[model samples]
Target: MKVNIVGAGVAGLSLAWQLVQQGVEVEMFERGTRVGEKACSWFAGGMLAPWCEAENAEPVVLEYGKESLAWWQNALGEGFVDAKGTLVFAQQRDKKELKRFARRTQAYEVVGHDVISSLEPDLASQYQEALFFKDEAHLDPRKALIRLTEVVQALGVKINFEQEIEPEDLLPEKVVDCRGYNAAKTVQSLRPVKGEMLLVKTNEISLSRPVRLLHPRIPLYVVPRDDQHFMIGATMIENGHGHQFSVRSMLELLGSAYALHSSFAEAEIIEMGVDLRPAFIDNLPRVERDNNIWRINGLYRHGYLLAPYMAKLAADSIFSDTHEIEKLADFKIKEDRV
Candidate 1:
């Protein structure tokens, strides 16, 4: 059987990879010419910290997201998953925020300044305590998407670029829509959550792993890329695709980074971006069949963290022809018409 996947973001590419592995013929349609283009996955910090995310995310996120790190290693081959872990710290005055985060999360070790210094030397002098999630990992989202496109093609899957598709217009035996925020056009319950991110480069400071800087209003994370570059983000604004970056957000982000390390004050701003991430009212993913199309979306901010598992579930649903779908509430088994 053949499957036509819409949207070449993390979800689409991941599903395509999974289906191809299951010996299914796969063809993908993407509106953008290049991978990551027009997809919010491009702006992601690439953090695989399921435990830290548990501070606000549902328990289900922890279960599925934890599996993603291993899935990515298998998908991308060895050396792709960075297992340096995640470090979370807060200002001395706002240390209560750290306590609250620790209370909500698990699989973390609370470390004092000396241990924190050994783990992240730059942060040791500034913050006296931190929560370390040792099993967490990260990857470069842009690189992963590009490599996924190549891997799928190498596996005999075809990708059609700049091809905007409507599910009804396609004649494929099966269709899987992973269109992220654009899925809102058909899925009314899916809403857009605008997120803004920034890229900066500085040789003044170095961080081995992703670090979260906790603040009362603006919580920020800095994910290190190759060289002296870091991807810092993100502001979660409800609804609307305000594509332009806000001055207030920039101030808060930069101010927070500076608070984490004064060296960030001299860091050269590289790039700034804004994209709308799709989310349900409850901020979880769903798999549902509407006619011949299987819509999988509402990843929210957990794009990299959840794509692997979502793709596996989608592949299993198609292969086994199962009806009792898990995860989200709306998923239901329908008759086989494919």
Candidate 2:
């Protein structure tokens, strides 16, 4: 069957790639000139730390996101994933939150100042204690999306760059909407959660995994990229995508870095971006059919974390002959997870 998809971000590309792999002729439409160019995933920290996300995410998020490790390892090649896990810390006064977080999560060893300093020598004397999620992992988001686009193209997908079309007309055998937050105005209950991020060049410090700095108001994290670069992010504000950064956000983000490691004081700021993550109020992903179209949105901050399984479910729905007659029922998309 011939399949067509909208959007060129990770979700759109992932969907197209999965369909193509199943021997379907897939064509994709992108209003943007390149893949993964303007999407939120481009600036994400790419931490596959499902356990750490347990602090704010649903249990299913971890269950679904854990599949990311093996999927990414297969997609990006072995040794591409940084399996050093996540380092979570709280202020000396907020030690109770740290203990609570540890209690709620799994696969971690409580580390004292000595072990913490030994793990990240640069963090010596900075944090008194930490909970290490030893089973987590992270990846390079920009590289991963680019590689995903390349993989799809190599698999014979016809990616129509700089092209935009409405699904109201010219429907193919199957239509999938991977437009992320843009679907909010169309779908019910899906809201856009604004996320702000920063990329900095730190010749002075090199940390091995992602570090989650606990803040009473604005929780933050730092994801290590290639070379001396690191992606420090994510201020989750309940607003729309406003490119302008708020002064309070900068202060909080920078302050979190300082608390994580003092060497960040000397790092040169590289890039700052803000985008809206499409998410439901429940913060879980959903797949539903509308007339002739299948909508897959509300990835929230879990795009890289959930797209593989989502795409597979979508592809299976499209190929299911029985579902062609019924929308949701035909969508037997059993969360047939990764």
Candidate 3:
């Protein structure tokens, strides 16, 4: 079988990888000049914390996320994933928020200062207690996307960058629309959620894993990257995307980072990114089919965590001869002719 995938973001790239591995001839088109240029996954925090995400997301998210964790490791190799797990904590005054998070999530161990210190010495002085989701993991999104592109290209998948063609334009060929927010016009139910993030470099502190700092109003997570770099994010603004970061978001993110560790006050601001994440009303992902076109989107903030599984589902439906597509989607859309 031959397939064409649009939008070379995490969703498209993952599907390309999956289809190519299945011996299907795959061709990908991207509007951007290159991978990660216009992709929201480029600015993602890349947390693979299914249990941590379970605090607010649906159970399906956790289930698929856990499967995605193993999929990523197996597909990309163990070295690609930083399996140090995730840490969630709160200030003394906001201890109730920690309790609330703990109540909603599972697969974690409550740890005191000693365990906290062992996991992240920099945070030991600031936080006395935390919930450790030891099975969780993280990765650098930009690196992961680049790696996926390389893997797919090596597997003989052809990618065309700077190409902007709608799924309808590729008629008669199986098409998977992983265009994300770009498909908002046709997928009327899709909405954009603005997310702002920051990249900071601080040599004073070191962290092995991602850490979530709980607050009543603004919850923040800091994921560690190589060479004392950290990805600090993100604000779930209901407004659409903007070219610049909002002052309020910056202050909240920086303040939250400072609260997590005082050294962040002196950290060099490496980059500030703002992008619109496509999400449905339920904030869960979906795989919808309209004749020959299949749309895989609505990953929200769980791009890296869920895109792999969504891509797998898309691949499965493309090759399957039965009505198993409905069973693979988080939300079922009646099959309709375009």
Candidate 4:
């Protein structure tokens, strides 16, 4: 059996990886010149913290997101995923916010400044207490995308870059649409959620894991990368396609970073990026099958956290002789045409 995957984003690449492993021929078409260019996953924080995400997301997200952790580690091999876990903190004035977050999420241990310092010394003096999700992990989205692309290609999947193929154009050809926000026209329920991120480098501070600074307004998360660099993000503005970051957004993001640590104020700005993430009304991912064309979309901000599991469901549905929609009801499998 053979399949044509549209869009080489995390979702499409993940599907290609799974299908090829099952002895299926796979060909991928990406409009971007290379991987992670046109995809919203490029700007992701790459946190695999399902428990942390459960604060705002549904239970299904946490369930499948946990399963995807092993899938990513196995697919990328050793040393790619940082399994140090996630630290969530809030300001003293916003202590209620921390309580609220803890109330909504589970699988975390509340710790004081001593433990916080032990986990990330840079944060010892900044936060009095925090929630630690020990089972969580993170990876660099850019590195993961490039590595996954290489792995799939090595597995005999042909990837055609700079090639644009609409899902409808590949009708009756076993197409999997992972076009994200570009598929808004066909997937009417899909909406664009604009997310903005900034990359900064500072030698003054160090972090071992992703840290979330909870706020009533725009919550912030800073993921550590190699070379004293940190990815600061967390803006979920609704309905916009502009690629440039707004002044207010920049201020809030930077201010939140400063709140995390004073060193960020002097950190060198490495990059600023903005992109629209596709999301459904419930802000969860879905695997929708319409005849021979299957769509793996509505990943929202959970692209890296959920794509692997979503792709598994898509691959299973495709290879199954009988409809597996009922079996995957929790993943929100939709049989209606999109």
Between 1 and 3, whose lDDT is larger?
Answer: 3
**Winner of 1 and 4 under lDDT:** 4
Candidate no. 3 TM-score? 0.95
RMSD (Å) per prediction: 4.1, 3.7, 3.7, 3.4
Report the Cα lDDT for residue 90, model 2: 89
After TM-score superposition, the amount by which residue 280's alpha carbon in candidate 1 deviates from its true location, in angstroms, is 0.5
Kindly indicate the candidate among 2 and 4 with the higher TM-score. 4
The lowest-lDDT stretch of 10 consecutive residues in candidate 3 is 329-338
Ranking by lDDT: 4, 3, 1, 2
Clashing pairs in 4: none
- Model 1 TM-score, all chains together: 0.95
lDDT for each residue of candidate 2 in 1-338, tens digit (9 for 90 to 100): 88788888878877887787789998888877887766767877898888888777766778778887887887767666888888898888778888788888887888888888877777756787889888999989888888888888888888888877765454745778877877766786888788889899988887888988876776789988888898989988875666787888888898888777788999999988888888887677766676568877777888888887787777777778434322222222544442
Superposed by TM-score, candidate 3 places the C-alpha of residue 97 at a distance from the truth, in angstroms, of 0.6
Tell me the deviation in Å of residue 107 in model 3.
0.7
Worst 10 residues of 4 by lDDT: 329-338
- Candidate 3 at residue 271, lDDT? 97
lDDT of 4 at 47: 94
Residue 243 deviation, candidate 4, in Å?
1.0
